[model samples]
Target: MSEALPQHLHSAAYFGEQRDFWWNHDYVALLARRLALDAVIDALDVGCGVGHWGRVLLPHMPRATLIGVDRERAWVAEAAARAAPFAPRATYRVGDASALPFDDASFDLVTCQTVLIHVPDVPAVLREMMRVLRPGGLLLAAEPNNLADAMNVGSARHLAPVDDRLAVVRLQMVCERGKIALGEGDNSVGEVLPGLVAAAGFAEVTCWLSDRAQMLVAPYAAPDQAAMRDDALTHYDNGHCIWSRDDTLRYYLAGGGLADGFERAWSLARDAQRADVEALRAGTYHTAGGGVQHVVAARRPQR
Candidate 1:
């Protein structure tokens, strides 16, 4: 029998409408110019979840044809369906990032968004991406230091006790360490991606911070804000944060957190979540939203 997929594999919570606001079109256009995408005709998107990253980049590459690959068959199907509008110019298939099913030097551009963080061996995936990219081809990756979000101060938590806030940060830090230890990948892998790309033998490496901020203020009327609010509410209603309670507990235990302290940590987190939700409902919730996504770009050395 086939092994069951991970619980987070096909989660709608992540691929929801809020993803559309990830990049500002003008910012993408600026990146396109900087990367000289005008000369790129064939591009590959590895770990292309629902093809969002590819779709976002396609408009900026007027002559490019996109081929997206994902390990999950369901995401491949969804990506293919989502690429319908670009039919002849875009395609999706089931493939792993670490072992991409394509020939060497096949694409002029190879990229992924929030993909490296989930792979057990980021370097292996980078090698594969470089292998499929033509000499002189561009390799772009977007990953984030997600752990930083734990330190963000929201209106609801502004007056929270320092110890309580520290507990939240401690919980996230432990979970991140455990996640990496368990081979589940790093949640904040973006901080070192530039060095990784350079070490992987890619030349002329460069990095930039994503301009979009997920700021949610009173009224929550903007489409993106509304989506964010709804997503949070759904997760809160389900009694979890981004990851389910079970997943968090597993990570905590793996990361060296004592079993006895799990309940207290979890309870603190739940209380914070509840406070945020109540504040949102009362039109009093807001945050500076210092999300830390990094975009790293490099090129395969010309042979």
Candidate 2:
């Protein structure tokens, strides 16, 4: 039999094509301007999974040479391959976020996307990112308040009983807390980043919301809509909602949820997922897609 695939730090399902549409080109360009990326000559992408985040930043910072680091050797190899087109200007290495490999004051910019959510000690990672960033260099992080996204009302689930909806929300909330309690990191860490950055002694801290949304409507013909539909269907086929049932159960239990209560909540959530897929198949599903992703930016204080 073929050797089993090595398990990386995060779920394999998360690193998919859907991530490609997470931001709009124009919005990223705007962010580049707002962050003064033109001045950057050396950049570091912490926890750079497959180099996606670093690739996204390249076009906006023509003067920068990008370096990507990840704890997973597999991801580093893949990132290196993906960054081949950029050659000498881009490189990837296996490194930890809490203790980056580079020297202090090494980079003109330090950034990460959806990375902090997976780190158990966000502050430690922030300090490491800051250490390698030169004085006056930019530090940018993109993260999401996933709890809000979980609570969004889609057309298919709008008519769910209030009690049922509330149960699902409670399940997610408790699981988020449980994840943190278990040192798995926070699912909704985006909302607190600005405060954390300020407390970390960064200067000119600021935050912005991503302009991209995952709206899906009938026919689902749009490229993004099709990607969304495929993502939903993939989850349904895999017999889980956003996370695998086993993982959800572990988090729920860790968060102080009763075993019996999890059964009901999980059932409700699974039913909702099924309903979404069915609605999508019938071309009747729709949602405004108000996801809450925050882009937090700060500059290392000048000496």
CA lDDT of every candidate: 0.88, 0.87
Clash pairs, candidate 1, are none
Tens digits of per-residue lDDT, candidate 2, 141-207, equal: 9999999987896998898899878888888998999899889889899989999999988999999
Candidate 1 global lDDT:
0.88
Give candidate 2 misplaced runs (Cα > 4 Å).
Answer: 1-9
Please, what is the TM-score per model? 0.95, 0.95
Clashing pairs in 2: none
